[model samples]
Target: MKFSYKAIDDVGTVVAGTLEAENREAVYLALAERGLLPTEVASGESFLRGYLQRLELALERIRPVDLIFFTKQFRTLFKAGIAVVEALRILEFQTQNGKLKRVVAQMGEEISAGGSLGDAFASHPSVFSPLYISMIRAGEASGSLAGVLERLVYIMDHEHRIKARINSAMQYPKIVVGALVAAFLFLLSFVVPAFASIFAGANLTLPLPTRMAMALHAILLQWWMVSLPLILLLLAGVYWYQQTPAGRLRRDRLFLALPIMGPVFCKAAMSRFASIFAILQMSGIGVLDSMRIISDSIGNSAISHEFDKIGDKLREGRGISDPLRSAKYFTPMVINMVAVGEESGRLEEMLQDISDHYDDEVEYEVGRMTELLGPLLIVALAAVVGFFALAIFMPMWDMVQTVG
Candidate 1:
């Protein structure tokens, strides 16, 4: 077979070329003999064509549930003493997701060709994060791949739960906002104009609020040509700002400073940091390295920036708790727990405890927000709608009273 290969030469320059080989193993050995580290090898034009075809097939077959099921199934199979290669082959055949099947097949082939499981996964960094890869590498070194996979499944499950909670919390607010927007547009575009015609025909002097509403209706009806474009442009500007790193950082910082929601955001960040740090430490990664990885995965640039400072302090031989306490983003309780963990040499356990504690705090805060927001939003919406209704209707009511 002909293979396309990527390798780094002795002098560290990356080279890509095609070579004839029996399989990927042959290509890897051929490169290794020449003091090149083979990064990847795929068989010929046929492989590339087939891979693309299979990718589409896989996307149609895979769902979030399917991915979750596969993770669980793989964990089960591995625990049942199945060989990693065989387990992957079984998963490949069983997976409905075309992409997942192809990935499983590639992983199986790579493992069979003497590549480490982590190395096989490293080929798909988008699907598998550096944290995942690091854990797997640590597991392999400690001869505990199965244990690592189990922990990974647990971590992913927890992450998914958090996502579900956030989605659920946002759903009602989004619906309410959308409904209010539609109602406002309907009033301005149709209802208010009907009232305006009545007042005009009756030749009555409208109240100040009623006159203002009629004027707004007229502007909306007549100048939408200008207004619509302006609205779109403003939206575009906001989107562009959010897409930039500085803008995102500014927005996240703003979110963390919000009155009711700011504490929730901070708690969420702290929970994530605690959880990921705990997992990395449990996986046998060093403190400094784990902190770096955890910081990268925290997802908020502001929080991540703070973590960079923490990592720097650790590198300079400062205690973890001291740096974190100095940062002032973390709560005193969290700092104290970390200090205890560091002193007792059980930082991982302490981090896990902190994560568990904060996870509850986040959930409670979200629930409180939901309870408070529902009534607040309803009252606010009612007030706005009532104001518009009174503004338009009071004039017509007075005109009727005068005629009667």
Candidate 2:
């Protein structure tokens, strides 16, 4: 349940805002812990307001870059000795991103209404991840909000650059595949038909490749109405299957087991896990909490499920390295590196090093993938076009020789 409450702070200032909790008692305890005296607490606003707010949040095009800028600005303002409320007000008015501006305004309102900074951020779960909220909560408790937000800004910016690098590497292959498909379709629809008609006039024994090519074109032309829908239906079925839990697990597992791309993805996932783990730990969050938060952030269900297993063992009081070793997703080097970190009492620093190392690995693998896949894609395209050209022209040359 969410509650709207009016409370008095230690300074005799009144504040009121909304927050979610399991029950009213939970809400009261949360406020009381923050040194606020609740005067009135009630269930949150009308369903219509909730619906409109959700609609706005859904339509918001807020990006990671936006959040990075928000965090950096908030940190700078807070560090400059500006009051939290005043800093938030400045942020609310000045942010160029309309979505983030509104979110900042909402935070300002929550601050004015006596909501704790952590809970205020938590309320906008879509814009702020659990990791982000948890770190903020830690910072609030430790009186290090500015440092925490600065660290978050770094993590968010690093993640964006990593994704950009991976996407950049993939662009060439996408263009090549699109061009290949378009060229094949053009030949089948335009160029192949003319040769096919000429062949029909000759009525002679065509070479095997020519016959096969013409036969394929015939099948496509004759049953295109059926084939097109069937192709779409197959694609749709695969998409639906991949969405299911079991199907998703199996499919993602297959992705990690693939030849070239698999290693790249695995490295990226490991880097992400280490990066989040490091940043959260550096922000003074507990190891178990960091793992739980990282499991949600990694975006790979199979790898995430493995992290869940590690969390379960952490609850059992086992060290991180043991559970990680048992998981297939963790490379032996990672397990050893984690074990070293645990022994050294500088696990956060160690994890940050590991993350940096894998970021380089991801960069190297992406470069290698682009270098290898680009030439392979071009050669494959050439071979296909060559086959089509030879198939059609062979018959033409034979016919000309006979007439001569």
Candidate 3:
């Protein structure tokens, strides 16, 4: 069932949203989870609409920049010796993202109720990652929460920049490809059909290219109703499957095996692992715990799953470098650095160096990819345009010659 509720936020402002649950009790629980106090609750008018709204709310994500800003502010406040609850309260007011503000409010409530900072953060696993929680816990135990937060800000900000760079670099290609697809569809559905009618009335012998185009237009007209929904369903199914564990592993593996972009992605993942691992170590987290945290937080499931085995090997009395050497996802340079760092008791420094190296490599590769893909897309666009033009005009030329 669906329930619509008007709830008061942390600041006593009445906010309204929909929730899917069994009863009023469930609605209350759900609202409480979002740091809201229910003032009025009623059954929703439409079950389907409410369900969709609830799903949309569930999928709403807090942006990385918001997270970085939050962490930076908290770090500054905490460094000045502010109390945890007070800092969280300040953040709740300062934060712009509605969901993040509510999360901050809940964290403040938890802290005020005598919960540990790590526990408060752990309660919202969807917002804060395991690595973040682990580092927070380590910081609290060591009374260095400010430093931990500072490192977190750096990590989050750096990751955000890398992602932004990749996205910006690919924007042109995405636009071009989308336009090409749109043009193809429009011509096939509208232009080709009109031309097909003209050719039919002329009763002229059509060239092979014209025949092929007509055949495609015929198939499109006949099966569009069925094909459109089937294609959408197929895409949705593939997306859903990609979210599963096994399917994610296959997806990541495929991502890393792509020709040009694979190296860029692989380097970026390595950079992330190195940087996070170094920070965790410098934060005084144990190696095994750090490995586990990294495994859980790493974006690529295939690499994370492989990295998880290192912890098992560590438990069996193996060193970090030894296990990493067996992990195929890691490059030889990374393995060697790990070995050297382990030998010299400078693993943190070594990991930081690896991160820096990969960061440069990823940037360079992304630039090169942009250069390569521009020409490739232009050539592809020209080929498609040429094919369509030839298909439409070849028979027109034949008819003109016959008349002459």
Which sections of candidate 2 miss by over 4 Å?
Answer: 1-60
Best-to-worst TM-score order? 3, 2, 1
**lDDT of each residue in 1-404, candidate 3, tens digit only:** 88888999999899998888998899999999999999988887655577786787677779888888899999999999898899999999999887898899999999888899999999999889898899999999998888899899888887887888788888999998998888888878888888888888888988888888888888898999999999999999999999899999999999999888888888999999999999999999999998898898778888999878899999999999999988878999999999999999999999999999999998999999999999998888887777778989998898788889
Q: How much lDDT does candidate 3 score?
A: 0.89
The Cα RMSD of model 2 versus the native structure comes to 12.9
* Model 1: colliding residue pairs: 57-98, 58-97, 58-98, 58-99, 61-96, 61-97, 62-97
Model 3 regions lying over 4 Å from their true place:
1-60
Better structure of 1 and 3 per lDDT: 3
Candidate 1: count of backbone clashes, pairs at least 3 residues apart or interchain: 7
How many angstroms is residue 390 displaced in model 3 relative to the true structure, after the best TM-score fit? 0.6
Off by over 4 Å in 1: 1-67
Clashing pairs in 2: 15-113, 16-113, 16-114
What lDDT is obtained when candidate 1 is compared to the true structure?
0.83
Give the Å error, residue 248, model 3. Answer: 0.7
lDDT for each residue of candidate 2 in 186-211, tens digit (9 for 90 to 100): 88778888888898898767988798
* Model 2 lDDT on a 0 to 1 scale: 0.88
Q: Rate the local accuracy (lDDT) of all candidates.
A: 0.83, 0.88, 0.89
TM-score of 3: 0.86
